[model samples]
Target: MSRLDITHERASYQAVFALDVITAAGALIFLGLASKPTFQRIKQRRFTAPNSKNNSARDGPLKTTLGTYLFLWPALLCLFIAYVCRLVSDLLKTAGTINYDDDLGWNGRRAYSTADSGYASNISALTFTTALATIFFTVLLNGGVWIHSSHVQENGTGISTPRTKSRIWNSAIMLAMLGTGLAAWGLGIHARDVSTGSSGPHALLSWSTVLQHHRATRIMYIVHEAIVVAASLSVSIEVLREYATTNRNARDSPERKDLLRFAFAVVPLIWLRDIFILYDVVLLYVDTAGWSATAVDATTLLLVVCRQLANLAILGMVLWGAWRMSRSVALFGRSYYA
Candidate 1:
C-alpha cells in the first residue's frame, strides 16, 4: 500500500472478540428479561425465596407491561442479529490482511481487512450498518430498564418512597451506557471505511462524514467515561447507605449473601472495563510508534477479556434468574401467583 493509503480491520467494540462474546452471551439473558411474564415469575418467587422480609426485590409488584416488553425484546433481537453478521463477516475474511502490513501498529495483531482494503474485502457496508444497529439496540434495551428501575417500592405500601433517587441515577447510568455505545459505533464505522483516495477519488465515503464520525467518537468518549465514573460513585453510595436496612435481617439468608457477593465482585470488573477502554481511547489520540502501540493493543485485549468475564458473571445471574423465574410461570406462561 502507498504511504498515505491507510486501511483498517474490524472495529474494536463491535468485533467478535472477548468483549462481544460477553455481550452476545448477555443477549439471551436480556431476551429473557424482556419477557415480562417470565421475568416476573423469576423475581416474585416468594414461595422459595428466602427471608422475604426487608428484601427490595420482593416488595414491588412486577412490571409486566406489554409496551416495555415490546421496546426491549425487538431491540435485544436486533443486537444479536447484528453481532451475527459481524461475526460472519469476520469469519469470511483472511486472518490478517492489513493495508499497512509493513507498519508495526497494525501488523500481526489485526483481525480482517476493510472493504476498501483490496479487491476482495470481506466486510461490507452491511456489516458496518449491523455493527451500528447492535449498539443502538443495546442502548434501547438499557433505556427500557432505566425507566422501570424506579419501582423499588410498591405504590400504596407506604413504607418509604420508591428509591427514586438511586433509581433515577441508575437510569442515568444507562443513559451513559447509551452514549458509550454510540461513541463506539461511530469510531468503528469510521475506522472501517476505505481511505479517501485508496478506493477511488470519490470513494462512496466523504471526508466530512468520516470527520463527523471521529468527532462524535471523541465527544462521546468523554461523556461516557465521565458518566460511568459518576454512576459508580452514585451506586456505591446508594448501596452503602441502604446496606444496613437492606441486609439488616439477612444473616439467615444465604441466597441474599450469594447475590451480594456476585454484585460486589462485578463492580470492580465494570471499572476495569472502563479503565482499559479509556486506555484504548487514549491510544486513539496520542498513541505512538514501536512497542507503545503494541502495548495499547495488548492492554486492550486484556480489557476486553476482563470485561467479558464480568459480563459472564453478571449475565449468568440474569440467565439463572430467568431459569428460576420460569419456575414461577405455571402452565401456558401464566404467573404462578396469578
Candidate 2:
C-alpha cells in the first residue's frame, strides 16, 4: 500500500471503531430505558394481586398490552447483539485475529479485504444478528402496536373476542416468521461462503457487504429484505386504518394514536436502512476498481454512520413509545402510577 492508501485504510478502521463504540453505547442506553417499564411492571405483578380491586382498574386493560412492551425488549436485545458483533469484528480485524485475504479484493488494497475463515464467520454472525434485529424489530414494533390497539378497542366496547387476532395481525406474524426463517437460511448459505472462503470484501461491520458478491448470498438478502418490507407495509396499513377508525373521544384513543404515530416514524427508518443496504450491494457489483482508497474508506464510514444512526433512532423511538404505553392512564400499579 502507498502512503496515501495506508493513511486512508487506518483512518477508515478508526472511524468505524469509533462509530461502533458510540452506537453500542447508545443501544445500551436505549435498552436500559426501554426495560425500565418492563421490569417495573414485572415487580408490580409480583407484589399485587391480579384480581384485587385497586389493581383491576389500572391493570385490566393495560395487561393486554404487556406483550407490546415485552416484545420490544427482544428487538432491542437483537440490536445490541448486532452492534456488539460489529464492534467485535472491528476489534478482531484490527487486532490481527482475523486474517484478510488481498487476492479477493476487487479494488487493489481495499480496506475491507476478504477474510479467510474465522473473520468470515464473524461476518456471518453479524449478518445473522442484523437480519434478526431488522426483520423482527419492525415486525414486533408494528405488531405490538396493532395488537395493543386491537385489545384497547375491544376493551372499550366491553367485548373481547377472537377477532382481535385480526387477519392483518396474523399475516404480519406469518411474514415475520418467514422473514426470520429466510434470514437464518441465508446465514446457513453464508456459512458455505465462510468455510469455502469469502469471494468478496467482508464489510459486514460497515454494513456495506452482505454476501452480495456471491450469487446465493445476494439472492438470500434480497428475498429477506423483500419479506420484511412486505410485513412492515401490511402492518403499517393496519395501524393507519386503526388510527382512523379509533374514536377520538375514547379514553385510550390518545395512547393508541401516539403509539401508532411512533410506529409510523420507525417504519421509514427501517426502509432507509434497507435502501442503504441496496446501495452497498450495487456498489459491490458495479466494481470499486480504480476507486481511490479515500473514496472506499469514506464510503464505508458513511454507510456505517447512516445505518447505525438509523438503528439508534429506531431504538430510541421504541424506548419512548414503550415508556409512554406502559405509563398511560389506563395502566397503573407501577411506581409511576403511584
Candidate 3:
C-alpha cells in the first residue's frame, strides 16, 4: 500500500481539533494578559536596589516576586504551541500524508511510521520539546508555590527569625533539578531514537505504546510524574498551612483565597491527570488478561479523550489562578499576593 493509503478516525480527530482550538485560544489570551505583569515585575527587579528591604532575598529567604510565580506565561505559551502543532498534525493525518504505524496507530491503520517518515520524525521532535516544556512548567510552578508559601509564613510573623539559609529546601530544589535533567535526558533519547528510525514501529501519536515499549522513556516518565506528585503534595501542604494561618478578614486575604483555589481546585486536577496516566498504563500494559477487544478499544478511546480533557482543565485552572494573582499585583504593587 502507498504511504498515503491510510485511514483515520475522522470524528475522533475532529473532536481533538476542536479541543485544540479552545485550549490554544485560552493560552493566547493568558499570554496577552500576563505579558504586562511579567514585564513589570522584571522592570521592578532591575530598578530596585538588591539591598532594599523589599528584596525578600536580601536577608536570607528566597526572593518571592510576581515574576517568580508567573511562570504561567511560558507554561501557557508552551501548551499553545503544542496544541497548535497537534492541530496541524491532525490536519496532516486526515489528508493521509503524515506517517502512521500499523502496530501503534489507532485502529491498526497501516501507514509509514517514525522509522520512515520525515514528517513523523519532526513531529516526534516537537512532541519531545513540548513535553519537556510541560514538565518544566509544572515543576517550576510547584517550587514557586512552596517558596511563596514560605515567604508568606516568614513575613506574616512580625518576629525576626534567624537569617540562616534553608539548607533543606535548597537541597530539595537541587534534587528536583537533577531528576528533571534525567527525565529530559530520557525523553531526548526517545526523540532521538524516533528521529533516527531506531525506535521500532512507533507512530507519531502512539504515546502509550511508546512508553510500553521504550524502557528508558517509561522509567523517566514515572520519575517525572513522581517528582510532580511530590512537588504538588508539598504545595498542598503549604497551601493548607497558609489557610490555617491567614485571617479571612485580613488585607492579604485575597492572596490566601487565590492560593486556596489553586490548592483545592487546581492541585486536585493535576492529581487526577496523574491518576489517568497510571490507569492508562494499567489498562494498556498490565491488566489485559480477559478483556474483550471491544472493551479494550472503548477503554483506549476513553483514556485518550479523558486525558486530554484533564490536561486542558489543568491548564485552564492554572491560567485562571495566575491571572487572579496578576490582577492582585496590579491592585497592590508587589505585595505578598503577587
> CA lDDT of 244 in candidate 3?
60
> Could you give the candidate ranking by lDDT, starting with the highest?
2, 3, 1
Positional deviation of residue 243's Cα in model 3 after best superposition, in angstroms: 1.3
User: What would the C-alpha RMSD of candidate 1 be, to one decimal place?
Assistant: 7.7
Model 2 stretches with alpha carbons more than 4 Å out: 1-9, 39-64, 97-210, 247-253, 256-264, 277-281, 290-298, 328-338
Alpha-carbon runs more than 4 Å astray in model 1: 1-79, 100-127, 130-134, 137-162, 176-198, 201-213, 236-244, 249-255, 292-297, 322-338
lDDT of 3: 0.51
Per-structure clash totals for the candidates: 1, 0, 0
Candidate 3 runs further than 4 Å off:
1-8, 46-65, 68-70, 97-118, 147-209, 247-252, 287-338
Residues 76-125, candidate 3: write the lDDT tens digits: 66667766765555444343333333232221212233333435545555
For all predictions, the C-alpha RMSD in Å is: 7.7, 6.7, 6.5
lDDT of 1 at 204: 35
lDDT of 1: 0.44
Any residue pairs clashing in model 3, and if so which? none
Instruction: Assess each prediction's global lDDT (C-alpha) against the native.
Output: 0.44, 0.53, 0.51
Clashing pairs in 2: none
